[model samples]
Target: MGMMDTLDEWHSIYIKAGIALPGALLSARFRDEGSDEQKMGLLLATALACLLACAAAQNNNPTENLALRGRATQSSTYYNYVFGYLASAINAIDGNMDSNFYHGSCSFTNNDMSPWWRVDLLKSHKISQIVVTNRGDCCGNLIDGAQILVGDSLENNGNNNPSCSEINYLPNGGTQTFECNGMAGRYVNIIIPGKETYLTLCEVQVFGVPVSKKPPCS
Candidate 1:
């Protein structure tokens, strides 16, 4: 018999004993050929497994950074770094921070009127939080007043997205994480408004799961 048929038979048995899930959830396909007691034991095991699976999934939060798979860019490049520092900084290798700005181990944007940097995750996600690393060298303070934005829109270089945090200060070589609280977005942006300044980043790490609209029952 098919798996679904067996599941349905077990469902029926549980229902008759007043201990089963609702009948509407059962889809007939599998058939059970084992003895009734064996069937009950198997069903009980399956139910326990399902419950354990759900608990495990809940515990498997996004501990590892999810931005390593994404692409990075800034509003404007400094043209001094041929190694694509802005593009490689999302998951850049460690650097001394003082001398590695041109090697793609960090990102540097030009002194534009509103310097910005962004990451394209390629798909929407329920963003939980973002960790941003600042350059350890002399000018890390340039990122002050930067706004962290998260949303699906690309307008204004994603600056139009809802703000998750406004960075006031970051010590040299400091790392700060802003909790987004499950904000939905595909783009993550950082910008300093109303003035020209450099936006250098040592690393950007995003944590979250893929966004879905489908029903959980499916």
Candidate 2:
């Protein structure tokens, strides 16, 4: 489905769950004439509203690291001459927290503008928190300014999804937790916006509950 369609689904879910969401306002901004900047602002506001609703739901539900059960991919893979494709995207979700890059337990992307990595949870979920582990060997600062986005759309490689939070700074080899406040989405994305740099993630753990039990991506 298209981005707007995906957003409509989110709006319906929130409305059905009895959460107050400005769905009409959101639709108007998208469907009516508006500047790109204004639309972008509205989009972020709508995403935040979804997140707040999800956060309320999280109060009564238990969550786990859903990323372990999901499929992972990245913008590009980093190939090591000696280790081959040791920096593959799947490493971050392998349930291992090894921070050393040489240990073959981290996902690394080729140095590129707006590098990103994503995980598909197989079904929509009300995400509560996302934990990211940075590489300890070196270059942890490169992850600074990275964004945590959650949504069902694959548009712009999921980078255009609503953002849960931004990493100002994460200490080397440090594992940081980002609260999504219950943003509902089937996909979670990590992207460094507006700069050319490597994206390395030692581990990415997502916690949440399924929004529905239905089969996805059919």
Candidate 3:
């Protein structure tokens, strides 16, 4: 079965068992009339539930103990939550290294011939690696060129300003992966300059440990 199917099965098992998700509940409460603060809080809660639902399914011992119940879990499911014509992925990898990472998949269109995909983590992270997978599958155009930006911020703003200090140029697309040598920053930007392909991202893989490269904690 697909990763999404696995997530759905897990959601059914752990979500409706009277476990009160404050974030999800609150989001639903004021979904329409809530302020930006409310919406953000709701989104964080939803992200948490998503992570937990994924964790419960991956773990075979959800009923083991309370410690197991409160722990956070990660998933490789590619949910298209971005505001573009492409889908994005949030994946976790296992290894001995500690770092921060982000991955995005972009789809091409006739209007935007030069497709560029970008996002900022908005917080500090020791990003050490990045990967741009080509899931063309013989349907969309292959991505042949790519670049990564790492710095204090992108475009002098905390929103999307990460300077493109490192680049990985691939003129022909099969599969491409880029690894940086331990750079610390608050934003990560990916730009793809190539043909516009339809539904190009199948999956994106981001690998990092939480100890040194901490995810945004509030």
Candidate 4:
């Protein structure tokens, strides 16, 4: 039989034997002992209460799922900009990318000189929307242009890559939201091509949805 079945059988035999065993031992010691039924009833109640207590304890012990949380911006400490595949959560709805189990891996930058950041998507991803959030108030990078490079290449040799094509443009500040035209690309490059103010960045959010040519039907 199963272990549970054996336990149940043993418990049944114990309960049966307990009816007379406790009272018989007590009667041997005392002249007139308490009733066996009362002793058996008390033991059964205690056993039931202990089983319920164990069940309650198991229920109270719950496991919490761990995930990433954003850092508080109000703090005075400064954090440098960062952007990579591991930085931002992959939120492509077309089954093209994977979700980021952690948060805030992607970010923008503000460099006064030849300010630019390169992101190698490695493979072509049809991206349509990008949401940018400043890491702190009065802290943001001047984003003059956004481009995407198609195919396999990572030119960190200080050579301005020719294959990179501009996908979005912002001549001045107030550029937190960028809705791309559903551009397909492998490598994405953001150009801070101007001598803007002190650069600051918080987070960069890339969202991908299916590109639809036809307008909404009435």
Candidate 5:
């Protein structure tokens, strides 16, 4: 049987043995009179309960967007003259996934060589996935070939960090998820290399757990 099945079987056994009682009550009830089997069963049940609780506590949900708790910046901001809107980097982390740039929810960088955007998670995390939302109104293809990088170093504005994934293509108004497979880092960067072009993103979502919370290397 699989690990989960084994755990389920143990859980059922724990419940059937009536060993799920309060710790103090169980200790008092079996203090001096219970058979050795009963005492051992109680000890095993307690251990199992603790194991389950620890497992649940360590379970990291890859869907939780850790970017929302961080700060963001880009190489340069795009200014809309008529609308008087500045496409700031913080727009991407504002939790608004509206892909229309005109809606003022997307972040845009000025046309520049190797324009980059980054989010500082403030602490190291074992990043498992990243989701990028492409602009729908226009210029969606500009995001193609962008590199997703993760690391703790600030060298070259974090563009030099280890790459997580490269975007081959993301359609207009479409959201794409990239798996990083637990790359440890404090900074998540997105940059378009080898071109003088605008970089726009409606949303950048990062999923992971803090490094301190991760189990130690075996």
Candidate 6:
């Protein structure tokens, strides 16, 4: 019921999860000095502040997935289902690469010629890499010949964007990561050239730092 009690509860959970409590979070010295309400409040606040700072550090880590925040649009939806296998699934940022139908819109497309899927970062970025996932279930071959394209252009529906990587054929329920070497772009697209096909994608992730005059991720 007290601040220390709460901290101890979280500490136990973290230990069980294989995380060690930081020294600052222990704060046994501060506790020994006083039981003052204000002091305990301040300690709790400081721990929270430190936790938030740790989170920010993790956000800046290159390994963090950056696609969850972008906006996605596809050439066609299986139907116009708002949450249906629309273009949005590619950037749902779920990191689910399974082919299970219960995976619920892991990826699918409207039957169309040259179907395309794209994500708008809404700001220019120095893209580092793009990761593509194939459906695990039947017909996972739908992603064959997919091109990873990046640029600021809307010309030809961004199909004219420069290619970062071309997917030859991703194995069923497989994932491929392509390094773009810091290509600058506000748009990232995936397309299978010269084909009337189903562009099924379990997920697509883009990692990058926003293009800015100041420090991009700071």
List the global CA lDDT of all models: 0.71, 0.85, 0.39, 0.35, 0.84, 0.72
Model 2 ranges with Cα > 4 A deviation: 1-61, 213-218
User: What are the models' TM-scores?
Assistant: 0.70, 0.70, 0.37, 0.34, 0.79, 0.65
Best by TM-score: 5
| Residues 41-83 of candidate 6: C-alpha lDDT, one tens digit per residue | 6566556654654454334424646667777777876644564
Q: Give the range of the ten consecutive residues with the poorest summed lDDT in model 4.
A: 66-75
Per-prediction RMSD in angstroms? Answer: 8.1, 16.0, 18.8, 20.0, 7.4, 8.1
Question: How many clashes show up in model 3?
Answer: 6
Q: Give lDDT: candidate 6, residue 195.
A: 92
Q: Is candidate 2 or candidate 6 better by lDDT?
A: 2
lDDT of 3 by residue, 4-113 (tens): 34434434544543234553453353425668886666556656766665554433222211111111111112244463322322221111111211233333323344
Q: Write the per-residue lDDT of candidate 5 for residues 108-200, one digit (tens) a residue.
A: 999999999999999999998999999998888999999999999999999889999999999999999899988999999999998999999
Which clashing pairs does model 1 show?
2-30, 4-30, 5-29, 5-30, 5-31, 6-30, 6-31
**Two-way lDDT contest, 2 vs 3, winner:** 2
Model 3: clashing residue pairs? Answer: 108-197, 144-170, 153-161, 154-161, 154-162, 155-161
lDDT of 5 at 25: 32
Give lDDT for model 2. Answer: 0.85
TM-score of 2: 0.70
Model 6 lDDT on a 0 to 1 scale: 0.72
TM-score of 3: 0.37
Worst 10 residues of 1 by lDDT: 91-100
How does residue 105 of candidate 5 score in lDDT? 94
